[model samples]
Target: KEYNVAILGATGAVGTRLMQKLAESNIPVKSLKLLASKRSAGKKLKYRDDVLTVEEATPDSFDGVDLVLASAGGAVSKKLLPEAVKRGAVAVDNTSAFRMDPDVPLVVPEVNPDALENHHGIIANPNCSTIQMVVALEPIRKQFGLKQIIVSTYQAASGAGQSGLDELRDEAQEHLDGKKMDAHIFPVKGEKEHYPLAFNLLPQIDVFEKDGYTHEEWKMIHETKKIMLNDMNSGAIKVTATCVRVPVEICHGESVYFTVDDAKDASREKIQSILNDAPGVTLKDDPKKQLYPQPIDAAGKEDTYVGRVRPDQENDNAYNMWVVADNLLKGAALNTVEIGEELVKRDLI
Candidate 1:
């Protein structure tokens, strides 16, 4: 069966990778449409040997599209994803826009492909940090039963989009040249303060809410539960996050501390063995050889790398792990494409 696919935000970082992943995917594609804003419209992008022109996205763009892979932004997704669905396209959105909406199913193909069956035309891709963390823990959760999760994320500059990557590069050169560094997009672009992310780490990703957690952190906490828990209202699994923007250009590194329900059966070796066999996960834990996943090694990869698995000294039921993945790939683009493939496999689209 062939499907017509449209990519919203086609010219952006995640959108660009979505196109690449789709080309590499097995989903039968009868047609491909690239949709972006007016500024990127008329521009051309290469798909294998075929050059596709970018069209300005509108309600009419989804007229015959069977599937839509979207990552434009929250506002863009909010504005157009419904239009796509109205026109009969099932959208896999890589944005925070429809994520928390009860009607929309937030899914990670590895953790919860079954969630795709409940989709009402829109499937939200979880936050990049949350995506990798859940993928690393899901196998453990399935085996030992998850109880809690506390994650500290070392997010990349690319999380802010292409402008953030450009800013990081320019700032690095400026700092080395002894010139005053200029900041415009890090630590939240809309915030009054913009700090250089070249040699510094910002504790904030999105705006802070009344509870003092940044919106990104809040998303991690709630989105984790939404994806992992059987009930959204269940406080069964506690999840908290501290999201920080690091100087890395790509890939996100996370130190995840978690506790399992089955303390008697959950051992470091047992967890490692389970992860090794889990789908979409690559186990890299070996402390003797000093082997573990690294951001550089995980960059551009699809699998979530898990390493440094150890039982917590204070709590037998608790454990710690290091997880890494390409934020643009597994976290955003690849996951979105995988969702599309799952839909095809299930005949859901």
Candidate 2:
């Protein structure tokens, strides 16, 4: 069936990539609509030989659209998604606005395509960092049973949206000229302070809460639990995270340590064998050749890359792995698109 698709926040980084993916998608499209803030209205966006003008996203934008892919910020999503759904469009949102809502299914198709079956006209894309890690680990959890997960992320600036990328570039140039760099975006922009992300690592991603964990770190923890649907009484997965922003520009890389509740005989090779064939996952480990997943290599890719698999020395049932993916693709656009595809496949749309 052909779909009339509308892309909200069409001018932003993830929104732009969402348009590109839709253009290249195998799904049949009857019409493509681009909607953004008033500041980006009337901007022309090229898609498959067609030039679509960006319209201000409003209640009327979803009048005839069948599928709405929303990559707009949270406030915009909070205000617009219900309108799209009310207008009979299924919204695949790439924001945190409704992800934790009990009614909205927080989905990563590779990990939980079944969640799409229950969508009430809206499906949420998991966080960029959370999506890739869950894609790599879900298969293992299915086969071996996950018990705990501890992750330290080396995230790219792109995860912060376009302004983050601009900040990294401008800061690097300023440093090269031996001048003090200005930071108005990285870590958190609206917060009282900002810090340079050029040739440096910031331990924070979003604002710090009274609980001491930054919002990004909390997102990783809570979102992981929600996506994995860990049964509390059954000793489901325990997740903890420390999210950091590094100098990278595209992909987010994670160092993950996890333990399974399986027999102690499970070996690293066994885990590697399981991940090697998992869906939406690419295993690229070869220590002998100094080969492993890297951000540059993972940029623009759709699959989550996993490598550096080994057993943790202190824990008998624990293992270590590294996961990486383009923060804008599998992390955002591709995952949203995947959710839309699942809706179609399951006759949920």
Candidate 3:
């Protein structure tokens, strides 16, 4: 089956990657529509030897489109996602806008493609950090009932979009040349203060709420539960996160510690064996050879990589592992395409 597809925010980091993946995806495309802001309307992007022009997005953009892959931003998705649906397109949004909306399905194809069955014309892709974590954890959660998850994310600058990456690059060159460092991005662009994000750790990804946890941290906490169990207070699992923006250019890494509700049956070796065969996951643990997943190795890869498996000495039920994946691929773009493909596979579209 073929369909007309439109990509909102087609010129941004995730948006650009989404366009690239569409060319390689199995979903047949009758036509491709690229929508960006007014300033990016005339910009051209290449796909399968076709240099497609990006147009300004509006409610009418999705008029003839059967599918909408939105990566613009949270505010933009909140405003136009429903409009796209109203115009007869099922929007798979890569934002936090409708993730917790109750009506919209927060989905990760490999982890919860079933959530897409009852889509209200809009499906939200989980946060980049949350997406990779759950992809690595879903197998474990299924084999052994999950109890709690505590993850510390090493997020990439790309999570903030291309502007965040630009700032990191400029800061790095200036700092190395011993020039005065300029700070305008990272942490939060609109915040009262900005901090350097090169050769340094900010320990914060977004603005801090009254509770001291940043928005990025909260997304990981809430979105994980919603995608994994479809409920925040489902008591199915408890999740916590400390999101930090590192100087890395691409991909995100997480040091995750999880407690199994039934560890007796799912030991460390048992969990590792499950992950080895888990879908969308690539196990890379080999402690003797000092082998494990790394951001540099995971960047540009489509699969979520898991390694550094170990049992926590403090608790027999608790174990730790490292997870990594290209933030743009599995975390955002490729996952959106995967959802669209899944929908197509089931003739849901």
Candidate 4:
């Protein structure tokens, strides 16, 4: 059956990618609508040979749209998502707005497909970093039972949206010419200070809170719990994250260390075996041949890449793995589209 789809924030990075994915998606589409802010309204976006004009998003945007893909910022999603739902469109939101809401389902189709079953008109796509890591770990979690997760991410500039990528490119040119690079985007643009992301690593991603953890780090910790269906009242899996903005251009890479609750001793070989055969994951852990997933290899791909699997030296139950995926695809666009596919398969849309 064909469905009418609307894309919120159609002019933005993730939003534009979502439109591209939908155009290439196997799901039958009867119509497609593109909605953005007033500044971007009337801008023409090409899909195959069809040129669609972007319109300002409003409550009426989703009038006859069966499915809405929202990649707008949190505030935009917060304001328009309910309106879309009210008009009978199921929204797959690529924003943090409703991820932690008790009623909204924070979903990664590969990790928690069942969560879609409980959607109340809106389903949240987890943070890009959180989404790829969980896709790799969920299979292990299901087979061995998770106890804790510690992740250090090497994230791409794309996670910060188009401006972040532009800033990185401009900074690189300035550095090559030995000129003073102007910082306007990296670290956090809205904050008081900005840092150069070229040939540098910034421990800060998003603004920092009084408690010391940046919002991005906190999103990983909290969103992981929510997507894993861990009860807040009960301390199930202890998750900690150190999110870093790296010099990479597209894919987000994570070094994940995790401990399982299983009492039996599970070897790294066993864990590797499960991931090698799992869906949505490609295992690339062969150190001898200098073969492992890299950001360049993973960029533009839909599957999460897993490699460097080994046991933690100190703890028998703990293991370390590296995960990578394109922040714009598996991390954002493809994930949102996958949710739409799941909804159709389950008759939720």
Candidate 5:
């Protein structure tokens, strides 16, 4: 059952984490190939106790690879994943290139693993923000029918990839030293303007579409519907989002407000009871002791942390809660690796 795996973008933020997760996972990997751009080729990265050299990736890089784990940019994914597929490699991609393609399955393993059954050659990992929210809510949706979801994400800089993380750290030290802080990556890179994310928040992540909602916001809105409504005709479920880039370094936090269909049985305690036993979720809501889910606590963790489960006073069917997870882990790398495991379990590879 061992398979030869190739990790595209093996040198970037999510790419490197993908290597680590694969090393620690139960999926049988017969060999690992690290593929990056020509500039990063020849660099060495560790997988378990062995060192592997990065190779310049071309369509031929996937020749013998049974599975491809990709976190390269959308362009790289769009260019390379199909080549891998043509070569008989199944790709689990972490970019937006194929997510919305109707034929591609946008999956969060815990929320929509069954969607893996529908993939042609590529199974997409949902956006990091959408991944955590759906993981926290899908259990609730199953227990008490979900009718609506409204989310405002406090996203991490890492969501922009490694460069964003580096920019945030440099800006923080410059601000503390009273030096001019530099801005090159936050909000959107290569845009006309940039902002320092040190001790500040930008209510934007990615470019603004003509509709005035940023691309990240739109991803949350649409991806939520796609993942949640996989087996059900719940496309009527209302989903809205306001995505913001916060000053955090690792975990992404979210304030979510949702309404359930079976209001007669849904309450604060009832919601808490459901989430407490939900898979890949941790309930951290004991407000009497000043306990709640925080980014610092969720960093590097695989579970989605939830707290502040309170029924909205004005609406009998509505409730509010907080959700957090390591965007790099569950949101990207860990989830991608999990999809590979599911493929093995289902004999899809």
Candidate 6:
């Protein structure tokens, strides 16, 4: 049952976390290969008690890798995943490259593990924001039949990868020192515009499409429908999103309002009750004690945190809740590894 695993982009933010998750995972890994860019090659990364050297990833890197956990950029994935697949490895891609592709299954293990059944050599991990929202929404959808979802994401700088985190840290210190704060590595990487995220928020995550919604927003909208609705006729669930980068360092939080097809089942108690026992979800709603899902609290955790559950007064059939989770864990790395774990559980590998 042991498998040889290769982690693409092994030196980046999500990739580093992927190594940790894999080290701690129960999925039988006979060996581990860390693949990064040429610039990062020869760097040593820690996995459990051993330090493994990272190699530059190329088509030849997939020699005997059984599964490839790819968290590299979309361009890297688009270039390398097919190579991994052609070499007889199941590639769990964590980029937007093949998520919407008919051949690739966009999966959040807790939300749509069954989708992995249709994988044709590649299974994509959903966006970090979409992952937490869908995990929180899945139990609700199962219990009450989701008809609509509106989400505004308070995504952390970590969602932009390591450079974004470094930008935030430098900005915070420079601001406190009363120095000029440089705004780079945010909003969009190579774009003309830049914004500091240490003490500010940018209401944009990725490039703006012609429709005015950013790519991050559009991903949330489409990925949700694709992951939730397996039936072609039932895939008309309304989903809207506004993805924002907040000052938080680790966890991405979401403010979600949704309406169910069954209006009668949308009560506050009923919704909270359902989330209480939901898989991969933690209910932390206690307004009386000022307790709710917060990024600081959700950081470093694998479970999706849900709180602020309430029936919307304006719409009887609508409800609102807050969701949070480590952008690196359930959002990216851990979820990717978890999908591989599921594959192991099902003997797919």
Candidate 5, residue 145: the lDDT equals 86
Candidate 5 per-residue lDDT, tens place, 113-227, comes to 8888988999999999999999999999998888889999999999999999999999999999999999988879989998889999999999999999999988888888889
Residue 241 lDDT in model 4?
90
Residue 186 in model 3: shift from native, Å?
Answer: 1.0
- State the local distance difference test value for candidate 2: 0.89
List, residue by residue over 1-349, the lDDT tens digit for candidate 3: 7999999999999998998899999999999999999999899899888999999999888898999999998899989888988888888999888888888999898888898888889988888999999999998888888899999999999989999999999999999999977999877889898889998999988788799999888888888888887895566788888988999999999999999985357677898899999999999999999889999999999999999988899887899999999999999999999999998998887
lDDT of 6: 0.90
Candidate 1: which stretches are off by over 4 Å? none
Give the alpha carbon lDDT tens digit for every residue of 1-349 in model 1.
Answer: 9999999999999999999999999899999999999999899999988999999999999999999999999999999999999999999999999898888889988888888888899999999999999899888888889888889999999998998999999999999999999998888888999999999999999999999999999888888888888455579998888999999999999999999996457788889999999998999988899999998899988899999999899986999999999999998999999989999999999
- Please write out the lDDT profile of model 4 over residues 76-101, one tens digit for every residue: 99999999999998999999898888
TM accuracy, model 5: 0.98
After best superposition, candidate 4 residue 310: deviation in angstroms?
0.8
Residues 117-191, candidate 6: write the lDDT tens digits. Answer: 888999989999998999999988888888889999999988889998899999999999999889878878998
Give the range where candidate 4 is weakest over 10 consecutive residues by summed lDDT: 226-235
TM-score of each: 0.98, 0.97, 0.98, 0.97, 0.98, 0.97
In model 6, the runs with Cα more than 4 Å from the true position are: 231-235
Count the clashes in each prediction: 0, 0, 0, 0, 0, 0
lDDT, residue 149, model 2: 94
Screening candidate 6 with a backbone cut-off below 3 angstroms (N, C-alpha, C), the clashing residue pairs are none
List, residue by residue over 41-128, the lDDT tens digit for candidate 2. 8999898898889999899989988999998899999999999999999999999899888888899888878777778988888889
Q: How close is candidate 1 to the true structure, as a TM-score?
A: 0.98
Q: What CA RMSD would you report for each candidate?
A: 1.0, 1.4, 1.1, 1.3, 1.4, 1.4
Instruction: In angstroms, give how far residue 154 of model 6 lies from its true place.
Output: 0.5
lDDT scores for all predictions?
A: 0.92, 0.89, 0.90, 0.90, 0.92, 0.90
The 10 consecutive residues of candidate 3 with the worst lDDT sum are 260-269
